[model samples]
Target: MLLGYLLEIVKDRDKAEEHLVSIFETIPQHIDRITGDGVNTWCELQRLARTYLAGTMYADTTSEAKFPNTANKFSALMNDEQHAVFCSIYYYGKTTAQLAQELGKTEDLIRKALREAFAIIRKAS
Candidate 1:
């Protein structure tokens, strides 16, 4: 399921392979901080792949006409911390706890960062 979803989003086989390699290397360390051994990482990957595909499809379909200049405006408005947190969670699949540990911040702080990042991204669209 995850492979199919990733293929849909990435389209190119080389890119999909690269994504898989990156995810495989990163997910274990990130997930280990939030979950004990025996967690189903494969399922988590599937969920992420599905989510990314859905979001990409939605944005591609709706954003062009709704907000023509949103990409540049939002990129300029995003704070470094917010962007880092967003990438850690969305692109690298880190949980709040994992992100907190990496940043030496509390879980609450990581969650706040994620919320702020999402708010900016949402407003841009």
Candidate 2:
């Protein structure tokens, strides 16, 4: 699951595998937080991976990032706006404010779209 998620983000098997190992290496430091009650482990790990990659491959912002196909399972359930909000925030480590500015949307609306996106993902799960 982690590798699949990483693949969706990095789109390179070698890089994703290398990142998976790097992410796993930090697991011990985050074990307690990761084991918390009601925590979505996959989401947390993905968050960590995003943070990790943000400092590495994603650090150079010269080129724009690419999103997964909108028809991918989770995103297909969302409207175009929701998918954009979710992918920018979730996959690219963008904050709601950043997305709002980039999308020319109000922060509250971006947040609402993010909420709806999460609801769709949770329902799919």
Highest lDDT against the true fold, candidate: 2
Off by over 4 Å in 2: 59-65, 122-125
| Steric clashes per prediction | 0, 0
Best by TM-score: 2
Candidate lDDT (C-alpha), each: 0.58, 0.80
Residues 23-107, model 2: lDDT tens digits: 9999999998787899988778878888887887654332234676534678888887888888877777888887788878899
Per-residue lDDT for 15-107 in model 1, tens only? Answer: 777666665665565575336477676666665453444444322322123222222355456687776676555544457886788788999
Off by over 4 Å in 1: 1-13, 17-76
Q: After superposition, how far is residue 79 of candidate 1 from its true place, in Å?
A: 0.7
Q: In candidate 1, how many Å is residue 90 off? A: 0.2
